[model samples]
Target: MQKVTFKIRRFDGEKSWLQEYQFPYHPGKTILWALSYIKDSIDPTLTFTASCRHAVCGACAVRVNGQATLACETLLDKMLDRWKTDTLLIEPLQNFEVIRDLVVDWEAKVERLAEVKPWLIPRDEFSKETGCRQTPEDFKKINKNSDCILCGCCASECNKLSSNDRDFLGECLRFCVSGK
Candidate 1:
């Protein structure tokens, strides 16, 4: 295809709309690259969040055609092939308050996490100066769950949380604290 089109859902705090943008297509480009190109070359007002371009940071997570995926890790060609289309619909993640285009409010999520107190309480023997030490085997048990970057991808895909987030915390938070 000579060009790729993005139907991006935009929110201006008070209003929401879908805007379409088309740009020259390049091989091996990622969803994040398209967003950056649109923002830098076409519309300066477009907004999104991304950091640590690698998948380690979850800041770039967004809903691509109704599914949550990390923008940085998803390739445009792969998505096009999967959907068999040159157009893609990009929107903010579900089960969260939208602050703006592709930006969701994380303040409440952080507050919920804080309420659970997801931290290790060292034994009395382990003082503040020395710190608590864990064996390699002990650390390995929770290593995978601890890798959660709170990108809200799991929450977006979760049926329970999507139905009622106020009553249920996302799996990310649950797994993150379960290790503690």
Candidate 2:
């Protein structure tokens, strides 16, 4: 097995530092797997957040080699090919508060979404007492927009938010609005 190094930027409440660790490489394993290995076997203090190891939960998003992406969805082989190296720099997503190793505070995004009122404001029903019903064809048209898993990947990659000049509603809210 080949050796892979993960250079992680760590933040505690008082300060920040870089921590490095190495692991055995297996083909087709994801960054999440490597992180889990580090946390489980190497260092118990290494903290990150994840649930639904598949891509559905969006809880495992972190910056892999400086790109905002889901850890479960990113393969180590592909990342190694892209960067031509065995060392991967994993960091918490940009444009948010870093809670620890790879977890970021999502309160700002949630608070912003609250301001936008992302819930459905139903249209008047054709049947006076019931809710409006959408046809199959109408549902199909907007189906792709509903695929958003609220991962905040778009928010981390947003040009406006990255600029740190003005606060902007993230793409997740925009996607919700467009879908409705």
Candidate 3:
């Protein structure tokens, strides 16, 4: 068995704390798995998110080191190694608000998404007229990013947030609204 440590941030609105956990590592053991082990064995009070553990769900996204990533898909030892120099920071994404440990208040982000109208304008109008065609070539262009689980990984990495600017809609929003 291998041991890896997670130096995570704990916050409850006004208060903040930091803690580390050493966990047993197995092949393909992801950050989510380690966290689940900690939650189940060490501290049941620890809070995080996980649904389909297979990365189908975006709920498990969190910061590893300084970059946002899906906890379920992030390799434990590798991520630990990546953050070994500094604290393996884990916090809720920025640009919104925090709900609890590793979770954010995304209500506003959802609201903004709703504001985009999401290509529905063409949908209703096109349906009333003749059929509109789309080719596989168009689909393949951004097919990978299209699978974005709303993880907010790309959003957290942008420098605009630290700079405190609201102009940038962030990558996730761009991915959703832009066709190309």
- Collision pairs in model 1: none
Deviating ranges (above 4 Å) for candidate 3: 83-87, 122-145, 174-180
Clashing residue pairs in all predictions, respectively, total: 0, 0, 0
Give the higher-TM-score candidate: 2 or 3.
Answer: 2
What is candidate 2's lDDT per residue for 15-91, written digit by digit as tens?
A: 99989999998999999999999999999999898899889988999998779999998998999999999898999
TM-score of each: 0.92, 0.87, 0.77
- What C-alpha lDDT do the candidate models reach, one value each? 0.89, 0.83, 0.70
Worst 10 residues of 3 by lDDT: 119-128
User: The CA-based lDDT of model 2 is what?
Assistant: 0.83
Ranking by TM-score: 1, 2, 3
At residue 168, give the lDDT of candidate 2. Answer: 63
Task: Report how far off residue 106 is in candidate 1 (Å).
Answer: 0.7
Q: Which lDDT tens digits does candidate 3 get at residues 49-126?
A: 789988877888888776788899888768756656423567777665777777777776777677665442344436
lDDT of 3 at 139: 64
